[model samples]
Target: MMSDENKVGTYPFVAEPFHVDFMERLTMGVLGNHLLNCAGFHAAERGFGIATLNENHYTWVLSRLAIEMEEMPRAYEKFSVQTWVENVYRLFTDRNFAILNQEGKPIGYARSIWAMISMETRKPADLLTLHGGSITDYVCQKDCPIAKPGRIKVEEQQALDEYKIRYSDIDLNGHVNSVKYIEHILDLFPMEWFRQKTVKRFEVAYVAESYYGDTLSFYRQQISENEFDIEVKKNGQEVVVRSKVIFN
Candidate 1:
């Protein structure tokens, strides 16, 4: 049982009022943030964390993420985020997460792909070469049922909105924070839409990085009444990210 601690980690959190939307349900943006923090916590505890890798001029970058939620915790509700490594490859790793309600019932699950990169060259690092490939020791068979992030194409010729990346969007990596893109995509919808429906699933694939002062153009295509595909381009040409949002 003790070995499982090295394989999985569960961190508790509450759906504070500030973390919830006007409907008193936890917002996806905040939930996404918490999920990422759990990833950092799990990795750090296992010695492959960014802080440790940074010492060797290496860092972790998120490549793709997919989150599926059956329900969002309400305000002041107690919940927890559980994370575990699913697989470790040469240059990328698969991580999974579960959001449990107060009763320990899973309300959501997520699957993410990450890569370790050299900060100097900004190139992918060999995961099998790191820490003598001990990262494989943390792999768990625990199930994450959500589908992996799929190809999100937004061929819409019309841009719905445009903005310039600012300091607030930039992270320590000198690029836009992952969650910020989630926030911006959600912003594309009005309260009226959210009032009538709730998000059922969210997925994002980071194709490239966008730095501060870069202009972002948001293009969206409605796949269905409840499904939408979004693409974000830097300088209106280079795709920084693509996303899919499904509502219920």
Candidate 2:
């Protein structure tokens, strides 16, 4: 087994045309999806084998990711991504990742909290106990920022008008993935919408967990048409997720 100390490597990926948006920069979903792929590659380099998880009975699932982009990579640009394990918690492991241009200039950063879950029971297992040994000694730098999920409020009237979650919106975790939620909101508009418009800022908060069979009500209202407040609710109880999208 290659220890984490000897397991460092950089994964190079090209931003293909399919990965870019109308603005000619990487889409939020593609950026996140590629980051996960980078993490998988790094793990495989450590002899973990990218797709294999825990005796063929478990798999790694992304619980949450707090991603921040200083600037987006344009289409056809070559970027190098680096990932490393920071620490392991009881049910979740902390991983840190960074994206840089060909010249090594930083473009974005991301921190992911993931859980090792049983493929049979579909429930998470303790990270330290799953591999039947303590892997903490292999972790790299212990000093990584803790990116907690955020919180936002949705307007009552907007909640009443534009709120409803459909059956196809849920993911394997039984809740909507953060990136997919953004996609849903973006899909509400046409592709031409971005030619004269661009996302200046975007943020989301995962408030509570939702299950696969649960239908949610989505709510949103334009904040002067260029920005909007959005939320997902179940039975008008706890809000599952809240987000704000700003276009310039």
Candidate 3:
């Protein structure tokens, strides 16, 4: 286990068979999950994890994430994820992560923004108000190499599929989990695409919340041979999430 005194934590993981796609490479959703898990584990060790925050009637929520990978790891590949807080604001905090191969070289990086929300009102909570002024002092200066994710432009695209929210998709927030959204978007592509192309970069900005029983419409548009845009909406016009995926 990595220590918390340095303000950075490292967690080891293996790309198990379940973590891979049909192509036997790590799936985007699983990679995102591993990054978040690393962040959560570090936060817990530092006394501000979701469990600790729950005691204070607050929980962390992901706002946006951008990930860029040199290449996806294959099944049974061993890797280490290092995560640290890059910056902390009033309502949100920015965290950066590095995915390293067995040789300890970075194969990918990601940046994510998160907010703490009150369990009672479901409103944003101030970091200072929750943990006092000292919490902000424990930040790591290490920066992510990739740029932060921005708002995705939704263009005119045809609906690809309609999916109904299932019980498994909802998280403790009573809405669909963030990673599930990525899974839904990835499902739009056929198995052949996953075998031929590799995801070089993936960005997602969650907009509105989708609840159980609500049907989401998935849309896709090709930006280029290696780039694509995706959007999810509950109705025809109400957007739930927007994302862009770049493949190599």
Candidate 4:
């Protein structure tokens, strides 16, 4: 049996035309989706994926994510993503990912925090107790280049847009998927902003879960000429997610 500590998953993907923006470079949201897909595939192959967790009436939820990049891959560019579990703490697990260009050189990296929650209770489960044995034997010595995403202070701002959760936004957990939150935030920005600036870093903190038919309000604050803060809230009260985008 393969020890969880020794497992590493690598996924190769191409930035198709659809994955790129008007600038023909990969969009931040698409990169987020790819990173998440890599994590899901890695977990599923290790026998601790959604299917196995579902059998136990549990599911994994992303709590926080941060990504930093030197540049975005252009359309039709082939790249590879390597992911591994860094450590499994009491209630949360740390995972890291490396993004390699076609030539296999590091172009970007991401770190994510996740927790296992009961399907019925929707409360976090102690990962150590649930997984049987210690899975942190081979923790990655290297740390993520960027700091973890933190909570954003909501400022007085008018709603930028409104979106009603739909079937496409819901995931297997019966709530809006984490990646969808990034997409919604990106959509609030005009296409011209994407073409004019390149995102150097992106961070998101999942504050709360949202369900289908729920309406979400988007708000934005310009921290600086090249930095912006975004937030999504439910019914103008409960915050669903908060994000920061820094451009170069």
Candidate 5:
């Protein structure tokens, strides 16, 4: 709903080769996630500037993100992307984004949740306080109609694929970057299927740690035309992460 005309300029489109390593691409996905948040803050500042609480107090932090890519963008390819507010609920606000090619076809889309924080205490603040304005007014009718992240019941699936953890997947926080879970999930799909359908909603819970040299087996099954459940296990024994991805 917000416009570049009313705010700062749009994100810069860069043409570069795509990273080949799955883990590296995952990191870029996480970076893209952060970049969209920065864009949202720019929009907020354009409309509300600095929202004063009582004294000097205000900040925004990402609380959660749910996004779906029809296909993962290759390393270093040029792509154009844009983001805007979708809606805000209570203390959480939703942001929507689109990734396009040079020809202007959609490559991927995402929805993320953000929350207001107190600069001093690092605690959450109400949506009414930020005054970023109404999200519905800014929601883009063209791409804003995507379905909500659906819920799926977990069921066991045949073990069909495996991947070994590499040092690059680890982040400074000493854990795999959350987006790596997405890469592992996509690894279960054949290239043909991915080319035909795009992911709709990707939700994950990292259950355990995976170390270098560990082989993780992927288990997955389709629940509908637009949804599936995916899990990664260590050597057929321990579960590392479980996720549900909806496609359209």
Candidate 6:
């Protein structure tokens, strides 16, 4: 078995005041970005980071993600995110994370699925043979309490919002940034909704890519008073992504 240090990567962070919301807690979008960054840092240290893969015209893509948090760090609080590879498959892998408070106790957790794909052909690559099969060594048995991303289906509901993808919404891959969707989905509700409650969980699954100039139509279905399922379609036809949000 690999040593614990080899199986996991822990990185620290600070909840800057500017990144917090009116409630004085780190915003969901910022937390999502932090989680992605931790995934990058963890993968890079283990030899399969985007930097290394990009050299060969390959990159990691997020397939699905589910984040559950009891609470986010308050403004000016010091925290840390620890990430580990939970399982490795031929063409995909499962990665997990733990969000620790200032005192090193876990306050939240996340589960994610990723696939390494060739940037040129947009095809997934086999993980079993990468780096001479060294990827298997990083797989750990760490427990990630959050459930995997669930199925989100929104039918022909009236569109709640419409957005045109712009320069700022694009990521390095020339597609709408993943975290940007979360930000946009949250805007569908009124400020009163945010001011009155906290977000307890969020889940997103990428279906297809949405490019610049694509007009995205957002549809929402309320699962309950505090939970909702959202779907984003490009140009009123192609489904690009689906998500779920639950509030306290």
Clashes of each: 0, 3, 0, 0, 10, 0
Clashing pairs in 1: none
**TM-score of each model, paired residue for residue:** 0.97, 0.71, 0.93, 0.91, 0.58, 0.97
Can you write out model 5's per-residue Cα lDDT over 113-209, one digit (the tens) per residue?
6676676886777775455444335544446445554444457667778777788877544656556766677666675655566555676655666
Off by over 4 Å in 4: 1-5
Instruction: List, residue by residue over 70-171, the lDDT tens digit for candidate 6.
Output: 999999999999999999999989999999999999999999999989989988999998778788899888788887888888874799899999999999
TM-score, candidate 6, is 0.97
Question: What is candidate 3's lDDT per residue for 32-142, written digit by digit as tens?
Answer: 999888989989988899999899899888888899999778899998999888888888898999999988999999999899899899899988667774557667677
RMSD to the hidden true structure, all candidates:
1.3, 4.6, 2.4, 2.2, 6.4, 1.1
Residues 1-248, model 4: lDDT tens digits: 55544576789999999989888998878889999998889888777888888999988888889898988889999999888888889889999988889999889999899998998998898887776743554355554576666667759479989999999999876889888888898888788887777888888989898999999999899888888898889978899898888888
In model 3, what is the error at residue 166, expressed in angstroms?
A: 1.7
After superposition, the stretches of candidate 6 with alpha carbons farther than 4 Å from their true spots are none
lDDT of 6: 0.91
- The whole-model lDDT of each prediction reads 0.92, 0.68, 0.87, 0.84, 0.60, 0.91
Candidate 1 lDDT, 128-157, residue by residue in tens: 988898788898889888888888878898
**Positional deviation of residue 223's Cα in model 1 after best superposition, in angstroms:** 0.8
Ranked by lDDT, the better of candidates 1 and 2 is: 1
Worst 10 residues of 5 by lDDT: 19-28
* Candidate 2: stretches off by over 4 Å: 1-7, 47-50, 142-148, 151-179, 187-216, 221-229, 233-248
Root-mean-square deviation of Cα positions for candidate 3 versus the true structure, in angstroms: 2.4
User: Which of candidates 2 and 5 is the stronger one according to TM-score?
Assistant: 2
Taking all chains together, the TM-score of candidate 4 against the true structure is: 0.91
Steric clash pairs (candidate 3): none
- Best of the candidates, lDDT: 1
